[model samples]
Target: MDAAPSTSSRVQFRRRNVASRARWVEEAGAGEVVESKGKLWLTTGVTRGSKLCYNVEEIGFLVEKGALILLNDKDEMIGIEAIYEKIAVGKYGCSWDAFQAYKHLKSLGYIVG
Candidate 1:
């Protein structure tokens, strides 16, 4: 977290799919895998929290927008700025806007991914 103003246009955020309030609280292991809607989701171990197991582009979208804050192996919240750099190089994933949309829909009781 460098001291950049919150409104900076350089924030670099974009989402490629539907999002959810579900924080990817931790990187999942093969042990946490679960299946729903014919898609695999992992029990993130956040008191029943679940995150769809997936890829980099989408993850970058989330991190850049401040929607999904991924925790490192050490359990530290990753900053959007660092993610933005990686995204530029074509790595990482998740949708920040999708998370926002997921939260919005969840308030209405819709199960979103």
Candidate 2:
């Protein structure tokens, strides 16, 4: 498998707060270019209108994989630690543990939904 890229190669995204959910919107280049390079959407998120939106877990997974560089509304960069804080932790929630499990399974060649 191809290892995640370094910080320099990460794709940039701006966090977009929509109602109760926070969506990460790709901030650089065309969506097609990013999709071709990252196989984006195939792994996470959906295209809404002209923007590519990613769920919280998808943001965490992409960032952890060194495939994303998330930005705040102010255009400041966000780190993985900060991103982790946003992931909810509770029974029946999209918790960090679940994300870890998802990542592990994907690493093992499992096709996670």
Candidate 3:
């Protein structure tokens, strides 16, 4: 793991949709992948094959912490508000309240499953 950056690093993550309710992200696009010096994936997300995939809640938490900046297929920056909107649309157990709890738990130094 690298040292934490002095400022927030703008990472590019492409949306990898497995289903209507499942929203995951991968460090995609051409060129070099932006390094998030902080512990971005150490506690969140899971590895699918060679890629690190983040769910809706995980992505929201990362974006809220300024550890990620998601990008579209066209390489456009997806705003934080847009990210929250996407997270809100998530079904099943993923929701803004759930994300809030996740963020709060992480802030308290507890590792979330």
Q: For this target, which candidate reaches the highest lDDT against the unseen true structure?
A: 3
Q: Candidate 1 deviates by what RMSD?
A: 12.1
- A best-first ranking of the candidates according to their TM-score comes to 3, 2, 1
Worst 10 residues of 3 by lDDT: 16-25
Candidates in order, TM-scores: namely 0.34, 0.57, 0.63
For model 2, how big is the CA root-mean-square deviation? 10.4
lDDT scores in order: 0.40, 0.55, 0.58
Model 3 C-alpha lDDT per residue in residues 1-113, reported as the tens digit of each score: 99886974344343433111222343421112234344555776666666566666666666655566666656676677877776676552477888889877877778898
- What number of backbone clashes does candidate 3 have, counting pairs of residues 3 or more apart or in separate chains? 0
Can you give the lDDT of residue 34 in candidate 2?
Answer: 30
Best candidate according to TM-score = 3
Instruction: Point out the higher-scoring one by lDDT: 2 or 3.
Output: 3
**Which model is ahead, 1 or 3, in terms of TM-score?**
3
TM-score of 2: 0.57
True-structure lDDT of candidate 3:
0.58
